[model samples]
Target: MNPSIKKLSDIAQKTSKTIIGLMSGTSLDGLDIALCEISGIGPSTKVELKNFASVPYDSAFKNRLKAITSVPNVSLQEVTLMHTYLGNYHGELILKCLRKWAVAPSEIDCIASHGQTIFHAPKQQHNQPQMPNATLQIGDGDHIAHKTSILTISDFRQKHTAAGGEGAPMAGFIDEMLFTHDTEDRIVLNIGGIANFTYLPAKSKDRPSITTDTGPGNTLIDAAVRQLFSKEFDQDGKIAKHGSVNADALAAFKSDPYFRKPLPKTTGPEFFNLHWVENKLSKAGITNVSNDDFVATLTRLTAETIAESIKSILDDKSHPPLYVSGGGFHNPVLMDWLRKLLPDITISSFENLGFNPDAKEAVVFAVLANEMLAGEGFKMESAQTENISFGKISFPN
Candidate 1:
């Protein structure tokens, strides 16, 4: 065990810590800031989301990030500049949130930042022998710590990749900690820019719980809306409801090789972007579809992929109820489709479990920061479990 991990464990167990967990998903919508009071660890862990807010990214900032993300060969200098800029930008958002909540900066113990993922290339995606699975998240902890004057833990995914797992859906670690039940099997689904889930089997001995991306979430729908309707998002699925789904287009969308891949796999906008959709449509000779119909088909793509993934993992037995979180829950069309597809199982929001559905990811990072500060590490039976202390901590000067 590293001495630092031991020191953090002692600090986490002994002190009453206030942590701010920050998350900015691939959606580029806004920064989710969750102020939480966390105590204990593993099954005994307790979390209180005392304050929460989503600071929307300005159109200019959004465009800048979109330009950097959508293009293939961005300059390294631009990426470097954005990394530091995002750290300071996030720090500013934190201070603004603290002021709105009337909390003193000194009262906050630490900040756990998920950072902004610019690119995620799993070995499966790249298949390059020497490269290994690689991912990048900007927002430097040193800049955050220096600007916020608080201990900061950032760049959490690197540790997971270093441990030989894809640096994604880190949500599984926190989901198992907070939602695992002894008597029933449960699935905690998060539909962000991408869809992913954690399967907690009814038996505690079912070592190595399952977690992986379930194909597209809102990424495709949002992209279509922007391209066809000039809207930022589908806006409660209203546009989708107005449009009908084209069966031919829907079938083509579902035929992608990704949906057929085995579990423990992951993907992102890189694979399911507007170009991917257009290419499929072009191949199917259906380029003349209506904008609304396109949106509807995109929404169905998310629901169908998600339903298939769940079936692949759970099969006939239903132990764990499905609890969902993330921005996608707000989409009525997608939710309605899921409800119809998963009628046999109980489907509810994370709020029912005492956590805000939208703020759950942010809170998880806060808990991770607490674990890092306290020097606690996770041990999992799954191949995905690295059993290593995740996140690098930077001290404020």
Candidate 2:
């Protein structure tokens, strides 16, 4: 047997494994590195988030990435080069983080990397009968494995697309495993560049789970801020808190056909981008709105859309508390709007459940890698992501 295969076999039989999970969301803010010690499998699975960090991307690097991501056209050569460059860069970042934390590469069993998503084209978005549900996430697993000298599992979304999924919001597997409660139904909401959630029915209820995108989260707000306020994000939602929402602009934004789509659908910044927002503004004939008001309206749009999605999943009598994790959780104004919109539903941070909201996505990737190595298969209440194993594994020679 190859030495790498033998090592993998040994690691699989171990009582516990240490894996470093990496996530670079569409926000392009940074790479989230989560050092996780995971044990067991399925419902018996357990994880300890030993260390976590967000290594921010510099302006030049971010610009280069933005130039290639989610656009209609791009240089193929640039895309190819970036695919390799990002993997190596992420490997170096992991090594640096390990060194900073006084750990060696040999101590880590695997690196589960959610590579940068340049484009996500589900059949719904593309309207191509010929193409299956397609999506692409760059940053090569082979490069990561070779550079980090650790077993790497990357491009997990391909497996989902191959298995007849929309290739997104893979949060259901981990969310179900980690957050499901026996007595209380839970909604594990991740408000990233594109907001999504996993509806984990109470174990006692025997209801099927549902996971879907809830439209924009911080994508529009961040893009508008960068162009207008010249900031990366609305820190604590200060701009939105002061500004008033324009009802006309809000209605125009909500008029999108995507919002009318059925549940279990997926979308990305590719659809809910700056251009989309600008077109909505033009349709609303709101040219002279204050920047703060624009931000506030966008923020309100996010809150309302998310609230509507959450409400759509619940019955009149059942109001499952929403435990939110991701960038939007930090925005007080967004949180405030959600509370106001859904007065009956309880809303709080995932921290209430003993996990770092920022680290949750990365940590979930780590859990996925663990299941791929030692578990039977990905089992979830949602059939949309069940009975499948994700991630293409790369062995370090």
Candidate 3:
């Protein structure tokens, strides 16, 4: 057996485990490094977001990722170089976070990494006949383990894809594990670069719960901001606040076939990038709109799509309280829109559930690593659903 597997086995026998969970979302912002202290597993799990930090990627690195995102045809050499480089990059960031927190790598039980997503192509995304749903995330796990000298679990999405999921929102597992209730229906909405949610019914089961990508979240907004304003993102949604939303443009944006698709669907920047926005704008014949108005419309587009998704899933009388997380909650304009659109239900942040909204995604990986250590696997009702023991183990020399 692998030495890392032996270590994981030993760690599970202990009373508690400390782990580091790292995530780099599609936004290309940076790596979210979360040092978590967790105990137990499944519904009995207890998690503490011990230390959290987001190490921003420099201009050069960000540019490279953006190039790969915008340009379809990338050289094999670039992909290979980024895969190795990002692993070491992530490992170094881990060390920096540890030193800053006054912790030791040897003290950490394991590291669960949601590696950088290079390309995400669900069968639906491609609409290609006879092609399997596939996704790719590159950042060598062996490199992470070798550099950090800790047992590492990485490339979690592959198991989901292999098990017949789109491999986009693996957050459902952690959301259900952490947020499920016995009496009240709850929806855990994550507004990252792409919006996704996990709807936990009042009753629980071993089967896959309701989970799907709502639509574009911050990806389109961020792209528009970068192209028009030369800013990384609309800070506090100030740009959006400054301008009025073009209702006609917003209506046109919402007419995409993907939005009308049934639940359990997924999408990415590859589908909702600047080109999508530009096409909608051109179709609506709105060329002279100010950058602020464009941002405002994009913000409204997100809110409308999210509200429409909620309406599609639940009856008008069935109002479930929503627990929001991810980068989108910080956007005042988006939050304001949701509050207005979802007045029937209580809308709050994940902080009320004892988890930092920003650290939620990172914490999920930590919990997943804990599950891997415990030798636990899950089963869902549908064989086509994602149900498995996720994460690939890597050893340190």
Candidate 4:
């Protein structure tokens, strides 16, 4: 047997494993690297986030990625090249983080890489009867493993699409495993480039879990701030705070059929982008919207859409706690709107539950890797989903 396979077997049999998770979301802000100490499996899983960092991308690199992201057409050459480029770059970044934390490559068991999402096209978005639901994430695991001399697992979304899911919002399994409560129902909201939430009913309630994307989170706001205001992000919602929401523009933003779709649906920056916003504004016959107001309304749209989705899932009398994670949680304007809209419910950060909100997604990928290696088949209640033992693995030889 290969030494790498033997080592993997040993690691899986161990009580705990040291793993690193990498997440590069549609926002294109940076790579989130999380070093987690994970133990047990399934509902008994325990994860300790030992160290984490978000390495910001330089403007040139961001532009290069933006060139191929979320569009119908692109240079195939660039996409192929970026797969290797991003994987090696991510491995280099992880090594830097490990060095800063006084860790070594050999000490880590595996790296779970949720590579950058280039395009996500569910059947709902494409409206093609002949084509199946599809999505694509670049960054090859082989490059990452070879670069860092560590085992790697990646390209996790394909299994979902193959299993009849939209290949998105893969948080339901983890949320149900980590956040379900016996007495209190919970909603774990992750507002990445595209916002999504997992509704975990209290174990006592005997309700099935539901997970779905709730449209744009920080994608549009970040885009408007960069293109219009010449900034990377709203940065504490200062731009949005200085402006007011345009009611007409907000209504136009919400007029999309995606919002009316049933639960368990998915979307991405591919669907909710600047061009989509401009078209909606034009359809509403509204113009001359200021930059600050543009961001403000977009921010409100994120909060409103998220709130509407959460409300739709809840029974009128039961208001479960909503714990938020991801970039949208840092936006005061968005959080304030959510509070005003869901006054009866409790809203808090994932920190309240002992997890870093920003590092949550990276940690989630790490947990998934742990599951792939050590877990006994765990499945969510919705859609007859398969077990959690997925992800293609690469051995460091």
Alpha carbon lDDT at 313, candidate 1: 77
Tell me the TM-score of model 1.
0.94
Q: Give the poorly placed runs of model 4, Cα more than 4 Å off.
A: 380-388
lDDT of 2 by residue, 186-271 (tens): 88899999999999998998988888998999999999899999899999999999899998899999999999999989998889
- Which residue segments of model 1 deviate by more than 4 Å? 1-10, 203-207, 380-386
Ranking by TM-score: 4, 2, 3, 1
Clash pairs, model 1 backbone: 8-373, 8-374, 8-375, 9-374, 9-375, 185-319, 185-320, 186-320, 208-382
Which pairs of residues have clashing backbones in candidate 2? none
Evaluated at residue 293, the lDDT of candidate 4 is 89
Candidates ranked by lDDT = 2, 4, 3, 1
- Work out the TM-score per prediction: 0.94, 0.97, 0.95, 0.97
Worst 10 residues of 4 by lDDT: 379-388
Model 3 per-residue lDDT tens digits across residues 1-397:
9765677678878778999999899999999998888888777888888889988999789999777663468988998998999999999999988999999899998899989998899898888969878889999999999999998999988887777777877788888887888777899999999999998887543434688899999999998999999999999999999999988888889888888899978988888988888898898787888889999999999998998898788886889899999999999999999989988979999899888888889998888888877746666443464548889988887
| RMSD of candidate 2 to true structure, Å | 1.7
Q: Candidates' lDDT values, in order?
A: 0.86, 0.92, 0.87, 0.91
The RMSD of every model to the true structure, in order and in angstroms, is: 2.6, 1.7, 2.0, 1.4
Worst window of 10 by summed lDDT in candidate 2: 378-387
